[model samples]
Target: MSTREEILGAAQRRLNLDPTSSMADIAAAAGIGRATLHRHFSGREDLLTEIGARSLDRWEERLDAARVGDVCSSDDADRLRATLVTLLGQYLEDSDDFGFALTDQFVLAEPTLTARGEALAEREIELFAAAQAAGVLRDDVSPRWISQACYGLLVAARDALRAGDVPRRDLDTVVASFFLHGAAAPGKPL
Candidate 1:
């Protein structure tokens, strides 16, 4: 990899572990001098924005690879859920910082990310609608609502992991449970 790519990769890794890390720390992790790190990225915000953009692109790619549209068209709710869970798991494992950054309310508020996020939300809603149509999801639930809930669950999972309040082993189960059963009382048909 190019020096720039190496630096960025190192920065991303460090950011994922600790978003508050300093440039010097990132430089050390990247095996570059502080001067070199500064030469590459002049400011923290600039570096952060670049990282965010790259991470967002990666996430967009993951979503695309999920074939959400095709899956939704099949009206396979379980498949849709599994697709999301798998994509999310990969995203978390590959780029935890990106996941965390995207989940951050303030970062997501940025215009670019916000626009992309909205578009993604629309796509997710479509998937949710298809699942509902398939009778896998509750017909009473709105797609928009379900999409929002999904986003919330994703963020919660990230935060829970970061906080060490939830074990990593339980991540999949937690996400699945939320998406499948929801918060409603048990034994009631959805």
Candidate 2:
């Protein structure tokens, strides 16, 4: 791998493990000197900006691959559910690699990244709205809430995995179920 890619991979892994890790920590993780790390990224903000952009790119790619927009506009409830599950699975698969982008306020709040995230989120909200209109999702909750809840579930799932509270094999199913059926007891009335 290229030196830059090495650094980015190492930094991402290190940060996911310890968000407070310093540049020196990242350099050590990358097996490079601190100076080399700085040569590639001027500072932590610079590094984070790049990571944020890459994370957004991954999110967009996953959405497109899932054909989320097209599925949202379609009348096929089964397709919508399948697409949603696929999209959620993609995020879960990469949660460790890009979880920081979802959790780091600074990364999410970066002006450029913020704009990108807003656009992506708008698309997600549209999907949720379409599903709700089709009776595939709860109509009582706003689309925006559903969209945010999906993200929140991802974060929670990641935490669960990190804490060993959930097994890797069941992560996808558990997350999908919670998002679809929520935590309410079986047969409980809403």
Q: How many clashing residue pairs appear in each of the predictions shown?
A: 0, 0
Output the worst ten-in-a-row residue range by lDDT, candidate 2.
Answer: 1-10
Per-prediction TM-score: 0.78, 0.96
C-alpha lDDT of residue 29 in model 1? 85
Candidate 2 residue spans exceeding 4 A from truth:
none
- Judging by TM-score against the true structure, name the best candidate: 2
For candidate 2, what is the lDDT? 0.88
What does the lDDT read for residue 46 in candidate 1?
69
Best by lDDT: 2
